[model samples]
Target: MATTGGARPYRPTLRAMSVVTFNVSGVEPVQGTFDDLGTPLHEVTFVVFDLETTGGSAREHAITEIGAVKVRGGERLGELATLVDPGTPIPPFITVLTGITDAMVTAAPKIASVLPTFLEFIRGAVLVAHNAPFDVGFLKAACAELGYPPPANPVVDTADLARRMLTRDETPDCKLATLARVFRTPNQPCHRALADARATVDVLHALLERAGAFGVHTLEELTAFARAPSPQQQRKRHLAEAVPRAPGVYVFEDARGEPLYVGKSANLRNRVRSYFTAAETRPRIREMIGIAERVRPIVCATALEAEVRELRLIAAAKPRYNRRSRFPERVVWLKLTDEPFPRLAIVREVKDDGCAYLGPFGGTRAADDARTAIHEAVPLRRCSERIGVRTRRPACALAGLGRCGAPCEGRETPEAYARHVTAARRAMTEDAGIVYAAVKARMDRLAAEQRYEEAAVDRDRLAVFVRVAARMQRLAALTRIPQLVAAAPGADGGWDVHVIRHGRLAAAGVMPRGAHPVPYVEALVATAETVVPGPGPTPAASAEETECILRWLETPGVRLAQVDGSWSLPVNGAGRLLARIELAYQGRDERPAREGRPLR
Candidate 1:
């Protein structure tokens, strides 16, 4: 053997020891299997392992010994013990503490050779260690050094489980020695790998016995029991047990069957189960789960369908925990009233009073931004007071500042004011060229004079208007169609079909894989839910629903299968305005350095 810097070089031993397997008290080790939630905890195999290393840090040290015991149903199935020849010398302090001297591992196999056999022993079993991260971290580091990928094994830390299962009065601490004494294990940890591993097995069994009182009978439930179990969560674990492991929507309902919350997930079982774990940190979620008496799962063929269904359920049930789309009718709209002056106004209820409506805005702020942009460009009356054609009312300060046409003061005739209203309505509904041109001219002049900050502000305002205008134009074109059918290839090998009636999603269903969609489409349309327009002027579709439909229709691969009415953007639509806005804001951050330079 050669020596370097007071450390012995790793040597391959002729007495190469492969992994040792033995049964404890004649009980054979059962092979481990996948973690199925349905599997009973007693049937699952656990490989409780531990490591003795040259130093505390896995990254800076090397393993000197490895020990593990495989157990199932409170019976020991197998055991493994091996000493590893660490490439570096074991520190004197570590040797004294663990009683593992340098000579003990002199001719032992190197970690690279021992790791493969150790991994094979623990394969198919849930890895358990006193403080798992330490042993697992060293194993991972060794694998990395050997250029092999680490094993994807589920790990359980007895220290963490002990903390949750044992009371302070019972153990006083989660240390392996403390737990060994409290549980009165046959094997006491002596700072050696095999001894510590044996002690961990006993600790694991003790914790499992304690966990049974909490109704934890499965491996999934046992792992979750590591977290501090709330009384409410422990009582409601059965609610998630019946949820299917499929993409779907899950509704949490109260005792009266009223929905408390609605959520979508790719895996209903896992997502619903997460509510009982410590991972769920939302305070509102904790409160909701506390009161939830039942969970209902509606399986969907695809995630997209799940999302759409979640939105619909949220809107219909108005779940107390859901904050979005609960009141779709509350969305604000910028309306051009049918009065003589036709001032821009924010209204929630859409009516058929022959007025030009611009949105289904998500909030008042966006609609207010559009209103300000349009008012600034076109001099429509800014006053809110009703002024008839015959009535004469004094003008406000806006008239003197030339911000309004002063229709109340009769400074502008009815016909003249009508023309201004027409231009504003055209900008809102038909074409935004006039407004865009005015804002662009002002932005250009400001930038030319080196008013960069003001220019940026105007540019942002113009962008808001352009985006809203484009959205309104697209929505209006869709609403004009009496009936429309659009289909897109779903991720799950089917076509997701949507039927739109009066701009609302009347019906939606999936065309099965490898099946003709014609009959399905016809049946879906005929049996579609009827959304009647209210006696007032509101659209049959809510803004949230319309936006959802529009987003789907605009997806890249979506195709319009059939159109019962015209569906086309106007030739002079606000689409071009969007392009102009994009051009104006491009490279805006670099504008400060390029001030006084002409915009391309």
Candidate 2:
């Protein structure tokens, strides 16, 4: 069915999987339907390692020894143990503790040379360490000094895992020595690198065995479990039990029945479950979960529907936890005032009063910058006061400066001023080549005079003008089409069809596998909402909604079934102008005194 502004569409709310089951162990049984939970632990390769350094601080010390054991599926693939030359004398106390004298590592290779070999040994594996901060920090510091990018591998700290899983009955402390004794592995730690690393691997297996009872089998679960989630999160894990494992928007409503937050995901169950797990690291979400009393899932047939619905829901509800897409009114527009001596004006609202508009700019600053660029290009008056055709007033200093034609004092006739208004209107909508040329030439003039900073400001303003003009014109083209029928390839050998009228989503549905799309398209178009054209580019829909439709149309596999109008931009339009302006911006920062300016 069709939905207008703030209206609900008729779609399936997945309720078939809402039946709850009891688990004696008090753990929510892990479901296979949650596909976004990352790689399984057994399928992941792990490099369990330990490092011995000269000091605790990575910034102030050097690594003395490195030891690693690479394992997958309880089988050891390889081992790396190497001594590194500290490049300084070993302290007497350290030599006595680890039983390594200064002469012991004299023949060893330097850290810079050995780092590459160690990195290759642990390539494409999860790094496990006793206290990861001490080991990983030193490796990162060394990589920075040598001008190599830091390793992009996932890390698991056995110390933090042990703290979250075991109690005083299991072990009094989370230290490697205590865990090694509790697990009673073959290897014992005696201040040696390889032995301690081997002991850590044994403790890691023991912790995993304990975690299995709590449904922590995946790597994503393992990392989140290490964060020691709050008690409230555990108690509220049942809220996600009724959520369908489908693409949709989920609202977290407080006890007062008001939405606390709104979010959308391809897999609703998996994403909502993550909020109660340690995987959700946002503090605001954590707070929202505490106040939320129920999970309301609105399942959709496709992710695009979920996205559009989420935007509208957030805008209507103004949920406290959601910071974006809530206040469309805050966006300002730059419209040419509909007057005898028309000028560019920043307006909070768009009206169908036969005026040209350039925006729905993000803020006043952007609209103001676009206004300045238009004035620079078109020689429009800058005063805020209104001027009449018959009334005579004193001209401002701008007339003497030759920036204005002195229309206020009748020095410039109404017919003459109308020409500038026409140019300004053209710059805002149909074509932007004139504005681009004028701004670029002025920027070039500034750069030639060694005024590089001032020229850069002009470059930024021109960029703003180009981007907004292109966006508004593109939206204008879309909104002018009375009705558009399009289809995007669905994931399951089907077609996701949409009916858009005046750039607003009128109706949407998905055709099943091997089903004919012609009937589906015909039925949707017949049942689609009727949208009357409003003034300006975005009529029935917000500028954001029209842009969303434009993006969906541009996606790779979309096919246009029908369009009411030409539904195309001018051959020479803002798109081409934006490209040339971007090139000038690229060279805007360079030295102006060197030679040729970038505007040409």
Candidate 3:
């Protein structure tokens, strides 16, 4: 069985028809099976459906009109059209586009009156429409609201059909009007139900001839062929539909349901959907799409919040697909402790307390260029000995290159040299005052010397530093010292925490951050330590609360630790990551460490 357009071939209610054979008496029921017709349909079966919509998007928009025509064996059926009152004011744009005005629908039968008959007529037919999915989605939504199950029919877009059918043609256009013109079918008034329905029929006739030449007369074969994108693309498409329009970070998971990719964006919905869009055919996206099983997202307030969240998820999940870069020359940092020949190092890894990292830049080359710019602006030692904390004599190798001024050889005092280092650190991390001060000072000096070019360069650097540094410190409050707290801000301006150990609850409590943790800690930690006589009530949590727990429990270790001022927990098992992290983070400070160890 083959269906055209978007309709599926399903059981149908056969239309009653009368035949006369010169009978004067009442006619008897016709007795025959499908074979009695004596001929089988060889051409594609098209279930052409039409709709007048209140607007575009299926999610927010409603359908105002429906019309359909079933065609097979080059014969089109009589029109089956219905008018629907969308239950809301139809905009003027809709009225202009569809020519379905309010007064006309005021007396017309509503969708409910015609739905049963319409569905019965369309069953066992492949749905067809000029732009089929739009109509089908509305039909499905209407059916659901009417307490009727969806038709479960796959849609075939006639617009897509035309595109494929004439891919090589250099015609005027591919719009319905152009399609009609190409086939020399008379132009029908736009937006009228029966007229557009008839035009669609003409378009399908022209398309089928081209499609049949490629052995694609049946809808089933073409549908199967079109659905062959990697499983990743499919899952990504599914996730794109689910994400809300918000700013956030999205995590893409692998087939076994593990996080494989983590990314952030100011517009979470748009950014995540980009990976699933048709143009994402690059090798990296293809691979990510192949492995991705889920797209989970967390909303944030700003682009910087999104960036911080993205970095946190990447570090915590250690997604197998995103391997961190290993090149040392590409990493940029602020040498906060550098003094007496202070230097700005371009290195891959962050060394403890030696320097503060500011970027994993757009690319390795940008980072290298930034380092070059810094070195040009401020002379410093660039030798292995000084960087490694070894004694160095005379000037380092970079002295002859004008990058080092031999400050380590007592050409400049350590205190005087420390000012430059402070300036650089401020430019990278704090970003607020130092860059402006340096630029203004240098600009004033250049202007006094009448060197406008040099002054302009300093001003531009000042602007660049301001922008980049602003991004780095966007979530300053988020990356603060971790004070053990019982809960995060809840939707209702309250907090929640549950105390459980060995898969059972000993006590559950909630306390404000300003309140002392001693009593709550005592109760929660005791739950983890005390052996209960019998199994306690299982933890009762809403979906959102359960989700919060599951996310926290998934970190790498069982015990909790703070990473760069953010609260973190460790996990041993990959499969139990979500559950484990949840348990660890819930009442984290309250649970005293095992064997009399300190909670901190």
Candidate 4:
């Protein structure tokens, strides 16, 4: 090897060293395909385990020892054991049972350094412990803090196996000691994990033989039978029984009565009960049970109408316990200024003005999104400045950028920019159909000029318009509102007119009983009969008729349509006038009306 200035070049050595991860168990096969003692016992592919703990209860104790034996097809292959010095005072009761004093394990390695080796040894084996969950739960809790996924392998609880095999009369309470005594298995110092594990293994051998005779052979069957009645299930059953069955929304409360969960059903009782008995579990439901102290139900109308009422209540209450619904209310409006050069601004909140307002969007975000969109579509000067941009000697930054069209600098004519702004506003607020057509026209021109890249951009913009149009079409499919025309009752006095809109029965309306029971769809259809559709609403309808139609459409169930599609009206003087102008519309574009405020 070449040497540097004063340092010798490093030489690497080629040496292979085999390192075994860990010994699985102390039992070793000394006979033909089996351990010298156990039987035609095929090596039981299991993680035979024991845990030395500071106390008896798994909940409040820490493990102080661990040991295991790995067996495959009834043949013991390896052994591993460790005395963990649990960093806690070992109780006198535990000390007497296991004979493992705190002093004995003081020199042993800490759990942090030993667990990795232990896990490696048991990697492919089904964990087997006497009363497995107690040990397993403690081990898993330890494992969790280390970011380990809890063992996915089945855990075979030997305690359960012993009880199933032993005669009830001979041994009713199958304690490890009792079973050890009955089976003649030697009792090593009980709490010493390794010695106890050895005793458990002996008991396991006998139980396997007993279980095999009764045809309980597979690992799956063994584990399933073991995990039947955990304390968690009993708790869930108690909760389910407490919820009342009724027509209402059930609120699951934590100890504080702060709603942790809210759910509604036709049969409150049945729905609440379903959570307890169901085999398939929802993690959230399990979480609720962990903290829940009480269940409360608030009665409501029919189940069919629960969703609507639920939304109203949730919106009003803004409950911390209830998760917010994904679909939120949006409210928006189009603002038309009273200035000489009128500017339209899409706003989340509408201002009182002589000009029109379009909507209260279903949600604040939706309305804000709409505002951003309209602003981008129409880059008109919506600033507080009263003077025309072109009239100024020094143009603002907007004019400096091409966005202003240099009208402020007088490079572009005021009339031309105004025309463009008008077109842009129309495309944004009233309807996007105009914007789509304009973009389509520009795209055609670009393609004709062989500007493919520019044409592609236009194509993308057109796609956006198509998407918006499709969404609008879908919205229209779900909602149908016709112009409302006031009507008289039929001869029989039973209401017969078709209601095109949902009308509230105000005290001023007919039916002195003050009942606004049924909404009048006929009113909406009759109102649509007044507007003649072409470029816009007709001059005749624009006078007083337009106001009537707009007012009626502004009602809850009625929405204003830019174009009147179709309608049916009675043949009265007002109806006759409406029929005549049903298709007539003013060529001028009307600004969208301003609703009260954005739907927050």
- Give per-model TM-scores: 0.58, 0.65, 0.38, 0.38
Candidate 3 lDDT, 390-502, residue by residue in tens: 44467766766655656656566666666667756655654444334444566677767877556655544444444334433432322232222233332234334444332
Report residue 266 deviation for candidate 2 (angstroms).
2.2
Better of 2 and 3 by TM-score: 2
Residue 97 local lDDT, model 3? 80
Off by over 4 Å in 2: 1-146, 149-226, 584-600
| Model 2 clashing-pair count | 0
Candidate RMSDs in order: 16.5, 16.1, 20.0, 23.7
- Tens digit of lDDT per residue, candidate 1, span 1-600? 111110222222224233344579888865533333345667778899999998888766789999989977677788999999986678899999999888999999998889888889989999999878888999899899898789888888888777656666787778999988887877899999999988888777777766666667677877766655556777898999999998899999999999999999989999999998787745468668889999999998656567778888998899999988787767788888877667888998777687888776778888887787787789988778777887687888888888877777678898988888889888887888777778778878887788876876766766778787787777667766778888998756888888887777777778889987788889989988786654222356655556667887888999988898687886777887676567765654333334522323
> Which is the leading candidate under lDDT?
2
TM-score of 3: 0.38
- Candidate 2 lDDT over 84-190, as tens digits, reads 89776667788777776778899998999999998998899999998888899999998997888999998999887776677558788888888877877667777
Looking at candidate 1, the ten consecutive residues that score lowest on lDDT are 1-10
List candidate 3 stretches off by more than 4 Å: 1-45, 57-59, 152-154, 168-175, 187-189, 219-222, 225-476, 479-560, 563-600
TM-score of 2: 0.65
132 Cα displacement, candidate 2 (Å): 14
Enumerate residue pairs that collide in model 2: none
